[model samples]
Target: MSTNHEELTRLARTLNPQIIDEFRANRGKMKNFPGPEFLLLHTHGARSNQPRTTPLRYIKEGDTYILIAANGGAPRNPDWYYNILAHPNDVTIEVETEQLNVRATVAPPAERDRLFAEVVRQAPDFAKAQKGTSRTMPIVLLECVTEKD
Candidate 1:
């Protein structure tokens, strides 16, 4: 099915709280799903301070959340990426049950290459995404901070 951004945004705004509640209640797992569609929330821009949330394909590497700034193979990086770069200190992530205060940083070149290889092995679209754009896609690592108990 073709996903409509406007309709999805409207529904997300209207039903996010409830959907989040359900996701939390299920222990971060969406049970009644035919696939992996109902999994993540929109991540807003921090520097421009705009409400732009794209459905990101992610995977956990150790204790970090790994994301790619592929922008569907666009020549320019996504605005959210620059926002994170500008305001690396003030970043927040909303998971199914928990909201995390995070520090966003771009992975180093060597590590990014390795991680990109791993991600492409899993989700081959990333390879296509790289081929679609002239610019090199960035791999970002979001590290969660733990507060003192």
Candidate 2:
């Protein structure tokens, strides 16, 4: 598979909103074609302050939503990663019809390693992604913040 950044960005910008809506409407049953395990994440752009969404591979560890900043094994992290890093408080996320308010944080080294291992086990492409880049991919944890009913 080609890992061209511009092409991926174009494809993502063009295809992600629809995918996210479909995934949301279908409760995550609908996924990216070819890569069935990836899910789209919608977030506010930290710098532009515009809404941004990207397809990402995620795993659930109990209540926490785990994601990796692999960016298809890019040399630099994804924009969304920096966005969340700049604003660690509460960010909105949508996963298969469930809109959540969550706090995003980079997992500690040990935890990141463990979570990354689990993710690689579930989706072997992650391992390939890791190998494609020299930068250490970060394991980002999105913890849902409960709203009082």
Candidate closest to the true structure, highest TM-score: 2
lDDT of 1 by residue, 21-66 (tens): 6666885665554332233434456655665444345777887888
What is the C-alpha local distance difference test score of each model? Answer: 0.69, 0.77
- All candidates' TM-scores? 0.69, 0.84
The per-prediction CA RMSD against the true structure, in angstroms, equals 5.4, 3.2
Pick the lDDT winner: 2
Model 2 regions more than 4 Å off = 1-3, 31-40, 147-149
For candidate 2, write residues 1-149 as lDDT tens digits: 65587776777688777876676677777644544255556566788877667766588999888998888777889898988886766476767657777878899999998998898888889899899889999989988887511
Those runs of model 1 whose alpha carbons end farther than 4 Å from true positions after fitting are: 1-47, 50-54, 147-149
